[model samples]
Target chain A: MTIREIGDLLDARVLCGKDLDVDVKSACGSDMMSDVLAFVKHRAALLTGLVNPQVIRTAEMMDMLCVVFVRDKTPTIDMIELAEESGIAVLATSKRMYEACGILYANGLKGNGELHG
Target chain B: MGESLAFHYEVDGGDFTSAGQASVKIKKNLRQLGVDAETIRRVSIAMYEGEINMVIHANGGNADVIVDDTGVTIILADKGPGIADTEKAMEEGYSTAPDNVRSLGFGAGMGLPNMKRYTDDMKIESVLGEGTTITMKVNF
Candidate 1:
């Protein structure tokens, strides 16, 4: 699905990268950047409640297309600028982490695969 | 790239937030060189993890990245307390980092494992109370 569809499905607010929202696909939800790094496949969007520059850096390193902050956790200006520079979109959703992930999952977004044992 | 280009970076151990700067540069450089997306991702992730470890445990270090027609090789060297148990250190969820470091979202004990996961070959050379050096290679 496109990032616009993801935003509509999750009730998310786009915080940055307004121009490229429609170009993204795939999504993964997690607060742990390491876990996200370990498991993210070609997933384009990350659903995270964590707010740190590392979150943006993690998305950049993983080649993710965007990040969604759950529960209305706002990203700092530095984070937004970093996302902008890295070319990853940032969004915020009012839904809690679990519900946001559920909505995306129900709409065909998936985790990279089964978690590593 | 031709002639096996090499890039070197000095990781500042004093600052945690600055840890992944080298990895970011390497990722950018790789992209400019037209390295495949998969290879770039692998190199960046592994180097980022290693860079984090250096800041948290060793204080800081130096990273050297060599890119060639075959693959990419990364060397991280630090003058920090060496790894005591290589086997235990490699275990997932096993960490020697302090609690404060965990608050920063690291110290998850995933660094070493993630490093190994992303690289085709990894070697750890460490001496207690002295320093440590890690060499990892990712083939295209």
Candidate 2:
């Protein structure tokens, strides 16, 4: 799914990279940055509730395209600036992590399983 | 690149907000050097983990990324409380970071393991009361 589609589906506010039209192959919902680093091998979108600069850094390390802040969580100005500098699109949604993941998954954005085949 | 290039940075442990600065800069450097995306990602992830570890456990450290003909090598050294058991420390889900770090989205004990998983080679050396130095390599 494209970043715009993700924002539309989740009713999220595009925090940064408003003009970005990138396509994300997968999505991972986790507050644990290590799991995202250790497991996710594809270019995916991270849906996390944890609000910190490291979230942006983790996504930057993984070369992720977008970060969807779940549970109505808002990142600090530092994080927004970091995301802008990294060219990563940021989104904030009121949906909880589970529901956010479920909505994205059901809409054809699968997980790492796509990499196997 | 025929000549080896090295980038060094001092990780400021005083501020948790600035932990991964080195990694981010390294990522940009690698990109400018025309390193492949996957290799850059791996190198960035490993270095980021090491940087975070230094800040959370070592109270800050120095990070060096050396890119040469063979590949990239990252060395992180810090003068802080050293790990008593390297074996246990390598295990996933084992962390000594304080609870406050956990609230910041890390300290779940996945740092070292993630570094090892992403890098092509990894080595850890430390003294009980002295400090720890981690060296990791990623090949092209």
Report the number of the highest-TM-score candidate: 2
C-alpha-based local distance difference test score of model 1: 0.87
User: In model 2, where do residues sit more than 4 Å from their true spots?
Assistant: A113-117
For each candidate, give its TM-score against the true structure: 0.94, 0.96
lDDT of 2 by residue, A1-117 (tens): 899999999999999985657788887888888878876547689999999999999998888899999999999998999999988999999999999999999999999723210
**Which 10 consecutive residues of model 1 chain B have the lowest summed lDDT?**
B99-108
Q: Which 10 consecutive positions of candidate 2 chain B have the poorest summed lDDT?
A: B111-120
Give each prediction's root-mean-square deviation over alpha carbons: 1.8, 1.9
Model no. 2, DockQ: 0.64
Candidate 2 whole-model C-alpha lDDT, 0 to 1: 0.89
Model 1, B4-101: lDDT tens per residue?
Answer: 99999999999886679999999999999999888999999999999989999999999999998889999999999999999999998999999887
Residue A95 C-alpha lDDT in model 1: 94
Q: Residue pairs in steric clash, candidate 1?
A: B13-B59
**With candidate 1 superimposed using the best TM-score fit, by how many Å does residue A24's alpha carbon deviate from the native?**
4.0
lDDT of 1 by residue, A78-105 (tens): 8899999988888899899999989888
> Which 10 consecutive residues of model 1 chain A have the lowest summed lDDT?
A108-117
